[model samples]
Target: MKSINGKVIWITGASSGIGEALAYELDKKNCKLILSSRKEELLQQVKNNCSHPKNVRILPLDVTNFEAMPQKGREAISFFGHVDVLINNAGISQRSLIMETDFEVYQKLMDVDYLGTVAVTKAILPHFVERKSGHIATVSSLMGMFSSPYRSGYCGAKHALHGFFDSLRMEHEKDGIAVTMVLPGFIATDVAKNALKGDGSAQNKDDDATKNGMPVSELAQKLIKAIEKKKMESYIGRKEILAIYIKRFFPKLLHKIILKSQVR
Candidate 1:
């Protein structure tokens, strides 16, 4: 694996779930980190748990605050002089049917899960270009590869990331910018518990699939490997990942199976 020691990496949504796990995983490599989230106190808690707490700077950020990203990005750059890697792991999930879901919920999903990431990346792109080196990693989901029950908006947002980042990779080769689209199947995270319901309220419960999926630490390690390899894209998790291939090679079969599954 490529050594990330002493590299400066910035992670959004650093308070919990995959983001928190990534911080811990990278800390072992002696990386300098900037942890960001809307909750400053929680971010501090994560920083405290890192291998070198003194080296981990906590930056409270809300990716959904599109207008604030330029300033936040500048602050991030100033904190560490420069960022070697930017991990976009901040996103919201949905657990609502398309027809019944509120239009506002869809807007929020696009705003937070899709455009929010675009905003942050655009804010930092100039720095990466000037340095002629950087890695951009986004935490996408299996839902991004194909549609699933009660996740229409969430899937839409993730699918958009695939398009945007793939195009970014196509255009930024000379700039030495690498983009890794990390598509995880399901890791034991609070995503489902905090997922948006049809009315735009938190889902407030866990899904069986997520509860039974790969551990977050395991997912974080796999993600680090992919990022170090500068992989264009990668998938993580157990059986859920196989569904991506099935959907690709046998659309009808995958559709039938999805319809019969207990996703909701």
Candidate 2:
């Protein structure tokens, strides 16, 4: 297994939820952290909360600003002169029906959730290639593997990540680059409240399923384990994770079950 202790790791979306939880967990592991997000103030707050606050640095970033990512990547690497792992955790969710959602909503989802990730990865690809070592771990939802109502745009964006990252792994395997796709079923976080609505507005509300999902701390532990093991794909969650297998062998039944769950 790969050891992350003492490695310089950069995490996007470090201001809240899963990202924030990871900062604390990784801090405990003695990992050097560079936290990035649009909210610089919140990133600082997360830094202060860490057990090893001195080991953490804050790098504010707007992942949607595609043109700026290359610079950001350079700045991230400069923090410790080299970065060992990058966690692509910056993303927004959706809570709208396809029929009612504006086209711009889909665009925003693609920009932030799909293309944004690609941009960041591309920004650091050259460095990884030159060094012949790196790890790219992304936080993709279970929606990436299967569909769900009211999450059409989200599912689409996440599904695209799998296609792109899988290709990245295949093309860079000889270069000693590692890719791990983290497919989370659900975790207690603000993802639902921050999800976009049909009109491109924040939902500003939490859902039952999300409120009762696995704790963020638990997910962080599992995420670190997956990274250490260099898993190509890691499914983490409660019973919701079964959907992946069910969709594979019992497609129709999975569809019926999802419809009956009324998750939205």
Global lDDT of each candidate: 0.91, 0.95
Candidate 2 lDDT score at position 249: 99
Off by over 4 Å in 1: none
* Residue 133 C-alpha lDDT in model 2: 95
Tell me model 2's lDDT, rounded to 2 decimals: 0.95
Q: In angstroms, what RMSD does candidate 2 have relative to the true structure?
A: 0.7
Q: Write the per-residue lDDT of candidate 2 for residues 163-216, one digit (tens) a residue.
A: 999999999999999999999988999999999999999999999999999999
lDDT of 1: 0.91
Model 1 TM-score on a 0 to 1 scale: 0.98
